[model samples]
Target: MSDPDLLAKLFQGDPRSIARSITKVESGSEGAAELMKAVFPRTGNAIVIGITGAPGAGKSSLVDKLALYYKDQGEKVGIVCIDPSSPFSGGAILGDRIRMATLGMDKNVFIRSMATRGNLGGLSRATVDAVSILDAAGFDKVIVETVGVGQDEVEIVKTADVSVVVLVPGMGDDIQAIKAGIMEIGDVFVINKADREGVIRTQKELEALLGLAHRPDMWMPPIVRTVATESKGIEDLSAAITSYFDFQKAETGALKFWSDALGLENVHTEIVEDQKVRVAMLPIGESRIELLEPTSEDSPISKFLEKRGGGIHHIAVEVDDITASLAKLKSQGMRLIDEEPRIGAEGCLVAFVHPAATNGVLLELVQTND
Candidate 1:
């Protein structure tokens, strides 16, 4: 809303306000940037758990049971399900699962379904924004259940605080986990449908695989058995989740202390609509650093991130006149990614130089509104 007090109402945990904010963010409509900028600081209070596995791994059942466990303990829970998109409407095929019918009735629980909308990662960009809105709205626990598209689901790591990979009691499921690279991203492994035959064999195979994988953090992931229908082992699964969360909290606190000591102030953060990116600017003396995060799979920055992990994307230089600079570069035989300067974040006119022209370094020229 144009009214500045919307954020205040959002922090008060009003469901209506939270739903409206999430809608604005999902559509990328006007004022969305302002809303998210205000929302970013109030987040980090909720624990985001990401559940992923192959199709029919009973991820939805697992999520439902886990959420009920949290709600019974007198905590507010938020659930975001990424479901397959309808080809015609581009909406979630399964808006809300019938299995969650019971949990949906609780006022303390919030449930929403997001469509992948053709995103290969099985996680739409709006999913993260939705989680942030819930976290800012004082939800104690937020659960994100992926679309369950095996390999491409690895993108869940970017948003989840603790990633749980659900598998079934079968040899085929174990091979599926390996193909999905679960060992690298899974903080906790689950063998759902423990009552099914071959449960022991699946556990032994999973344990053997875990033994082979070495985590840099040196923490051995624990395998939990779950029977979602009977709500068996739900308490044990909850305990495993808490253990990892506490471990991360301690590590994060140390990092935050060092960052504060260095005077690293997070100056400003805003979504760059034209680039489909969220940028956070930190001014360090005369030079400033901008951290870029892609909002969609088709975003140029997303391609960069997919090809190369985190690192410098490009270098930007400020020039007095962007038009003249572009003309000069064109005449000097320097390849230009942008033939003409375009409006960028903060009303700056920006243009890019191809890497080929700059000896394999992408460069951008910016002319501030001043």
Candidate 2:
């Protein structure tokens, strides 16, 4: 079938077509990028839940129960389980056979098992695309169960709408969770197998650790206890998930509303790879506000965030010639972060004037391609 026809079928919630589309992206088949480009706009309709933890944390069991709960509520559920790869075939060693026994039989529930495919983070490179396919295919809740590779699974934060860190009592899982740096990313923490011993102790430790965490949003992550085998606390888990999801939507809406009230028209967004920052341009009259979001932890913007939270990083002035401007500044005894013009977002040649030289304000000189 042609791409458009397949996409139409996929959008119609045709299970076979959805599987086919995911397979194409998973294999890096030709036209995969084009297919994803088409599928992108149809996404953001599904709430993507990423579940991760150490091995034997009962993550799969929790996922199965959670998915069934969503399915029972009349919402289409898509379950993507990342399993260890088979050495020779590079395919999921534990393919959907196990989950197929439970959820695969239901028309409203779609289950897919993806191989980690050598990604140490326990996620396949194409896993995000597979989730996007399911999202576009009209799944109301897409649950991504990772390979449970502990700390390495931090990549889950990037793709998931809400990140869930699953733990068990008496396994020292709380200590492991802290070591894995999972505490910071978890929007909702789950204590699965709550019937086990040391439940109270584990919860206390988790609470103490959470108390020490200082999120920029100042939102406290809720802890939900679950006994997945007996399906106890499933509703509570769902409620916690919903609460966080709704809170994020409200926060985002407030920001957009504030920007609208300020009359800042969003121009465009661009990634400056050299500095590892994503720039969002919003023009206000003659001046524009450039919001810099760090793409990596070691990036300069991230350091600024750690030290000063959120505020203006720099002010930029467009010039006719950026290189000449930098040279002139340097000759006049001005300290320059970039002695020569380097590429900034949107192909603009840019150079930075050090804060010391600019009266404690970092300044950028830009020469736009336009």
Best by lDDT: 2
| TM-score versus the correct structure, for each prediction | 0.65, 0.68
Question: CA lDDT of each candidate?
Answer: 0.78, 0.81
Candidate 2 lDDT at 209 equals 81
Tens digits of per-residue lDDT, candidate 1, 136-159, equal 999999998874455555665447
Model 2 Cα RMSD, Å?
11.1
Q: How well does candidate 2 score on lDDT at residue 141?
A: 95
Clashes of each: 0, 0
Model 2 reaches what TM-score against the true structure?
A: 0.68
Model 2 segments beyond 4 Å from truth?
84-95, 118-124, 148-152, 173-180, 257-370
Query: Once model 2 is optimally superposed onto the true structure by TM-score, how far is the C-alpha of residue 348 displaced, in angstroms?
Result: 32
CA lDDT of 150 in candidate 2? 50
Estimate, for each residue in 1-370, the C-alpha lDDT of model 2 and write its tens digit. 9888999999998988988988888778899999999999999899999998766677878888898888889999998877444222135534466566776576688888775555543245578888999999999999988745554456754479899988889866446546456777889999999999989998988888889865655469999999999999999999999999998785455347548688676578667889987777787778877777776799999999899977778999999988788878988999999988888889889989999998999899989896
- Candidate 1: give the clashing pairs: none
Q: Global CA lDDT of candidate 2, please?
A: 0.81
Off by over 4 Å in 1: 1-5, 84-100, 118-123, 148-152, 173-177, 263-370
Best candidate, TM-score-wise?
2
